[model samples]
Target: MIELAQDSGIWTATINRPEKANALTDKMLTELAEIAEEAGQPGGARLLILTGAGKVFSAGADLDAMQGGLATSPVWERLSSAIAALPCLSIAALNGTVAGGAMGMALACDFRVAVAGADVFYPVMKRGFLPQPSDPARLAALIGPARSRLILLVGQRLDAATALDWGLYDRIAQPGALMDAVRDLAADVLAATPQHVAAIKRLIP
Candidate 1:
């Protein structure tokens, strides 16, 4: 499930299924896409934050749903694309672990702020599956081809510090300070004119 709230110029969306490590279902992914669409509208929030409730950020697709053939890459792509297309700046606040397809969602965001001890990994290769074509390029763009290979091919689970060093995280926050750090970054972003911020977002690749 997804929880959305708006205050002033900021909108926050939290993945709420902590029992399953916040693994996304089809309906949840649909809700995320819908939220992204809403955030893109005129007079919408100037900043959007994506995060997870409880501990883990997301465990990617629900295994049961995948077993039922309900988890498809296209739907995931649609969700990621919707976030990427938003006119406002978007940030991924990684409260905990970020895994598998959820990595793509974070990569789609304009910035990522992570808890210092959170872990990140993609196990698609181990599962005998391939990610969407753009995912590798996005990873490479953030880090580099060598690190991307370590993640995508070697199945490396990167700690937050290493990921930050590799450029996957824009900032790292100490435990219990993740949201505060995110708010600090958001405040800095808010200091800029919304028009200019949106224009810069549009100008970025």
Candidate 2:
């Protein structure tokens, strides 16, 4: 499930299925894509924060959904692209481990910050599937090709420290401070005009 909240210029999207580690069903994924698309529209929020409830950011595609063709669905690509193309700043405030396809959206964000115990891994190889098309280049851009291969090819799970060291996460916050950390990261963008934020982001890539 997805829960969206708006305050001032900040928009937060929380994956609310904590009992299931926030595993994404096709409907959930599609909803997320729609939300991202909405954020990119005129007069949308200037800061979009992607996070989750409970202890995991997301366990990736729900098993049944994956079997139902969720793994190969274009929704994944669409969601990430929408986020990446936003005129505002996007941050993945990782609450916990991000596994499998969930890594795609997180990587697509302009910034990623995680709690101390968070972990990052994409099990594409182990699952006998390929990642979303833009995901690999995004991953490599953040952490480099060799480290990207270790996760995508060797299935290594990088803990918060290692992920930060390797450039997957930009900052590590303690559990209770996750939102505080996100607000801190978003402060500047939230204060800036939408045109200013979009101008800076466009200059990046």
Candidate 3:
């Protein structure tokens, strides 16, 4: 399940299927993409935050759905690309570990802050499936090609400390402080006019 909440100029989207580690089904991915598309429109949010309801941000594609062709679905690319193209700032407030295709959305965000003790990895290699199209390039841009290779190709799992050190995560927060850290980052943008936020974000890329 996906839940979206908006306040002031910030929008927070929470992955709510924590019982399954927030594993994403095809429908959930499509809904996220549509929400992102909406956020990029005229008079939309100034900051968008992606997070999860429980400990894990996402376990990636749902296990049962993966066998039904969800793994190679074009929806992953659609969702991540939409997030990357958002006019406002996008942040992945990783509440916990991120794995498999879930890495795409977080990688597309402008910033990522993970909770302490969390891990990050995309084990597509061991899973016998190539990652979503834009994932490798986006990940390589943030953490470097060698490190990206270590995760995607070698299936290495990175703890939060290591992820921050390698630039995979911009900051690490205690679980209780995760949303506070995210809101702190969003404050200035939230105060600015939507146009100003979009213009400044456009200047970055």
How far is each candidate from the true structure, as Cα RMSD in Å? 1.2, 0.7, 1.0
lDDT tens per residue, model 1, 111-132? 8999876799999889777886
**Model 2 quality (TM-score):** 0.98
Q: Where's the lowest-lDDT run of ten residues in candidate 2?
A: 183-192
Q: Per lDDT, what order, best first?
A: 2, 3, 1
Regions of model 3 farther than 4 Å from truth:
none
lDDT of 2 by residue, 81-194 (tens): 999998999999999999999998999899999999888888999999998999999999988999989999999999999999999999998769999998898888888899
TM-score to true structure, per model:
0.95, 0.98, 0.97
Lowest lDDT 10-mer window, candidate 1? Answer: 66-75
Candidate 1: segments with Cα more than 4 A from true spot: none
In candidate 1, how many Å is residue 30 off? 0.6
Q: What is the alpha-carbon lDDT of model 1 when measured against the actual structure?
A: 0.88
lDDT digits (tens) for residues 1-205 of candidate 3: 9999998768899999989999999999999999899999987768889999888999999999999999999999999999999989899999999989999999999999889967988889999999999999998888789989999899999999999999989988865899899888877877888788778878885
lDDT of 3: 0.91
